[model samples]
Target: MKKTIIFIMLVAMNFFISCGNSTNSEITTQKENEIVSNNEENSDKENDEGKEEQIIKIEDNEEDEVVISKSQAYLDRYFQLEKELEDSLAGKYSGTTIDMKEAVSIEYDSWDELLNEIYGVLQEQLSEEEMKAVREEQIQWLTIRDSKAGESANEVEGGTMEPLVYESSLAQSTKERCYELINNYMK
Candidate 1:
């Protein structure tokens, strides 16, 4: 009987130790996952920063015309607005509707102003044929932008975030077009 009791105690102790080790393993796995997730988030943020810092380098062509770099002031303003939006959205879960709307409006105004500046530059610099080509390209770009914006909004259709998403999509598309015009034609 004593031997049986000793055997039972040993089994119970072994089971408890095994359960403790299993719990520790699960905790270790959870911590590792969290660390990996945080690292990936940090890497994404770094990539975004690198993109924001990228300069558009233009070279002179065979015509001997002067090459000009992209406007730093416009890039600065664009990134500033983006940072403001991110700052405003930080730590907020759902009640950022008003803030998001205001940010989108501000971004839209900035994008429109940059686009107008690009248009003015094109008018001053391009020949008639070049202007026509640019106009056709602009029309195509507008079609794409509208389609993309609609699609982005549709992804959140009937949700509270749809308007904000649509406005953000518009702003992003316009900003990208502004950069393209600056890089490709502003020489």
Candidate 2:
């Protein structure tokens, strides 16, 4: 189901981001002067009112330190879409829609065709951080796709089954286009 796939993707993303951390170490800085100045100002105000001043501390979670530029975000989105398509095609999905005809429509005759096209677009635009993220995403996507393919091989029904082809092709084509765009942007 869509929920299951979404959950799986979220878990996978979390794993990707949080790998090799003891505590969730994120970037942060202390504004000593600002805090001190605010506290001092508050203390004076409280004293005039014949009351004790209470200091307030503010904390922040600074995850996602590697901020991607707008262009890079587009690239990353493309990369993610491609991954989703690849996963679906490989039947690594647990959704209600298991249209094989649709899934197979994005069949790339060769990886080189995909890689070359993607590389052409991405080699110039993306930053090092974005490139790294895309590469990591690619690996994760491929791993999921391969596992799904293996798991679903037996369950996939065979034969021409022509009438269902239109629906199947539509689904598969959509997935392929999504991945293609992503790969193109990230490459």
Which numbered prediction scores highest in TM-score against the true structure?
Answer: 1
lDDT of candidate 2 over 1-187, digit per residue (tens): 9999999999998987786452333221245566788999999887866532221111121222222343355566556656766765665233324455444444432333455455555656678887787678667766665555544443444634442344344344434544655545532
Which candidate number maximizes lDDT? 1
lDDT of 1: 0.79
Cα deviation in Å at residue 57, candidate 1? 22
Every candidate's lDDT:
0.79, 0.52
lDDT of 1 by residue, 1-187 (tens): 9999999999999999999999999999999999999999999999987765652222324243343333445556557756775676554424478866776777777787878887887787788999999999999999999999999999999998898888889988998998888767765
Residue 114 in candidate 2 has what lDDT?
Answer: 50
Cα lDDT over the full model 2: 0.52
Worst 10 residues of 2 by lDDT: 53-62
| For every candidate, C-alpha RMSD to the true structure in Å | 17.9, 28.0
Weakest 10 consecutive residues, lDDT, candidate 1? 55-64
